[model samples]
Target: MSMIKAHHLAVSYGHGEAALKVVKDVSFEVQKGETFGLVGESGCGKSTILGALAGRNKQWTGTLEIDGEEIGQKRTRSQLAKQQLVFQDPFGSIHPRHTIGRTLLEPLEIHGKDRRQERIEKVLTDVGLPLNFRYRYPHQLSGGQRQRVAIARALILEPKILLLDEPTSALDVSIQAEILNLLKDLREREQLTYILVSHDLAVVAHLCDRVAIMQSGGFVEVATRQQLLENTVEHPYTRILMDGSRGYVSERRKSDSAALPA
Candidate 1:
């Protein structure tokens, strides 16, 4: 079953006399328990599309369905909480002033009045954070730890679908690998449907089952990871991105190779 569906989604940033369409009729579906990646260069409306799914932008015009229910133009808090968005920058997503416990409790405090402590402990354990470190502030934790906290906070409400907007982009490669694995395992255990947005094809290749290539606010190509990386199909936009990424690697290899023995 599809967890989320977006068809002919168009987002405009301005109002009245100066309305500009940033996203141009993008259509896609996110399957349950699978990761659907949205990849594109900066300013390509990837995040704008993600915001539309999370219901962050109200001005967008399109059909958006979450769990078989058509989401209206104006979303209520309860309807909004059924899905969650995990941001690109984990550090920015979490508040420095709030400790882990306080951070995790923020959503529950507003929505859930009972079983707060029990919920906190469960989410913490689920995200691989212990209850003892719940009092630690964001500054006191490592990058991975902070992200885990962010994930915990997102999962505390138990949303069925998570819109991950470059969730691990800011972290180092080693840490990113760990976080990705954690996300995969958690999604499997918790049965989450994810819409992952990133600039790296390699990252998307590793995590997403299927990927959609976006350019200039439109999806020029959609294919599985194998088709994207291996098949090297013939969309001009996707080819450019893949070629550029490969070209960079080729140049880097020559540079590194030149420094070694013949």
Candidate 2:
């Protein structure tokens, strides 16, 4: 069974004539424990789709099912706890005044979960951060370290699915690999499903099992990772993306010494 299913999903901002539709009739399914990717340029509605799925955007229409239960309807706290979103900008996502420990504890407190200290420390360790680091504020950490904490904040709830909106895009290229490896390890260790949004084909290729290419708020093509690797995509937009990825790879080889994790 699909872990996530969206049928003819549409999302927009505002209402009536003032409304600006961002996602148009997009549909897809992601299997349990699989990493499905949405790849596109900025403003193509990739993050908008993720926001709708994560329940951050309520101005959406159509059927969205998570584990066979329809979303957009009122969900129980337990149902809401089954999914979590990890935002792109870690510094922006976390509160500046709050300590890392407080940030991790907030979710548990909201859910009324017990053993908050134990859960916080375990999540910090699971994300490869020292337990002592939790006592520090966001400003005390590096960009990569901040991103790790952001990820830990999401994982603290022990959600079965993660909506990743360009999770590594805000970090340095070198640090991106480390975080990607960390996510891969966490997903395997926790058996979590993911819907990863990224413009970087390399990042998607490195982490996703299947990919959907979005263009102008709609999906242009969907293909397996092997199909993407073999350059067998049928859509023109997908081909353009493939060409751009090749160019990026060529440029990176000359200038970037940091390789994506294997």
Candidate 3:
């Protein structure tokens, strides 16, 4: 089953003569329970597509279907709840004043879900957070803990699809792996589909079954994980990304080794 489908999708900012198109005529489908990744340099319309899909950016024209239902500029509450977005910066995304429990409760209250307390506790556990942390403010938690709370917030809605936008970019390298592994486990446990946007090829390769490489507001290539791992990707841009990602990993490893006590 196809969880998401888009054809000839174009997204723009502003109106009339001043309208700037950011995503141009791109098309793709993500299968149920599969992770689809979008990769490119900054400002390449990767997140623009995600915004369109999530109904945050309404200036888009295309055939878009989510979980078998067509989507439009305006979405009903249920339509809006079909998928949830997890942002890049956990600290920035969450409320500083709100307790973790309250932050999680807001959505459940809005959606009028039953057993709100039970749901909150379950989601906290699912994300591997202690129940007691619910009383803590966002500031009390570390970066990785804050991100797990963000994941818990998204999952509390019980949405089938997760739209992850640079989910680990703000965390330390060691913490990034922990969050990625949590996402992997959650996907299996929940049978969820994901659309992840990141500039890191290694991150994408680790989590995505297939990836779309974007440049200048359009898709340059869509390659499988096998193709990526085997060095069989055809696009020059894709190869460049692979090389850059390899260099980045090597540099990080060297830096880590140097930090170790001799």
Q: What would the TM-scores of all predictions be?
A: 0.92, 0.93, 0.94
Clashes of each: 0, 0, 0
Model 1: how far residue 26 lies from native, Å: 1.3
Model 3, runs deviating above 4 Å? 248-262
Question: Model 3: which ten-residue window has the lowest total lDDT?
Answer: 253-262
* lDDT tens digits, residue span 180-224, model 2: 999999999999999999999999999999999999899998989
RMSD of each: 4.7, 4.8, 5.8
TM-score of 2: 0.93
Most TM-score-accurate candidate: 3
Point out where model 1 deviates above 4 Å: 247-262
Instruction: Give the Cα lDDT of each candidate.
Output: 0.86, 0.90, 0.93
TM-score of 3: 0.94
Better TM-score candidate (2, 3): 3
Question: Could you give candidate 1's per-residue lDDT for residues 13-83 as a string of tens digits?
Answer: 98988988999998888888989999999999999988887888888988999899999878887777888
The alpha-carbon lDDT assigned to residue 223 of candidate 1 equals: 78
